[model samples]
Target: MLKFFPEEIEFKVPQVMKTTKWIKSISESNGYKLGELNYILCSDDYLLEVNKQYLDHDYYTDIITFDNSEEEDKLEGDVFVSVDRVRDNAESLNVPFETEFRRVLIHGLLHLMGYEDSTDELKLQMRAKEDECLMLF
Candidate 1:
């Protein structure tokens, strides 16, 4: 199941039904099944606290994913998105909020699919994958 909630923020994902279906399709295309995936939208401060508490990091990020999947083919986790960061990133990147939002949304799922971006080459690959996935959306 996929769910979205607001934490310390009053916001709703636009075109929610379409978004959910798109996310599900992305997971299915990768040969994985969705299992209790939750997205929590929050402000930068809220996400910062979560980062400090859970990740031991003191920086703001667009999204944070905690993989909780026990089964091999099931994707389960909590994805916390910082709306403040997304909005700023959208403006900085000169893209629509919804577009950047979708990019970040799928970025978390890509991580669950075993894609990493710690290296320059991996980051390029991840960006290419994200672009391809955005086209699907």
Candidate 2:
């Protein structure tokens, strides 16, 4: 199941239904099933606390994925997204907010699919996958 909640934002997603279907399809196409995927939208401060508590990092990021998948082919996790970061990143990247928003969502999904972005090589591959996935929209 896919669910979305606002942890620190007071709002509703415009195209939630469509986005959910797209995420589900992305999982299925990668030979996996989506299970209990939750998206929490929050502010930078809220996410910063989460990062410091869970990841022990003092930096801000667009999205943080807490993986809960037990097997290789099943994707399950909590993806926390910072709206503040998304807005800033979109502006910095010179792209529309909706476009960068979708990119961040898929970026989290790609991580759940066993794609890493730690090393330069892996980051490039991950970016390629993200770009490929974005074209599906």
Which candidate number has the best lDDT? Answer: 1
Q: How displaced is residue 38 in candidate 2, in Å?
A: 0.4
lDDT of 1 by residue, 23-129 (tens): 99999999999999999999999999999999999999999999999998999999999999999999999999999999999999999888999999999999999
The sequence of per-residue lDDT tens digits that candidate 2 reaches over residues 1-137 is: 99989996885665898888989999999999998899899999999999999999999999999999998888999999998999999999999998889899999898898889999999999988988988987
- Model 2 segments beyond 4 Å from truth? none
lDDT of each: 0.95, 0.91
Please estimate how well model 1 matches the true structure, expressed as its whole-model Cα lDDT.
Answer: 0.95
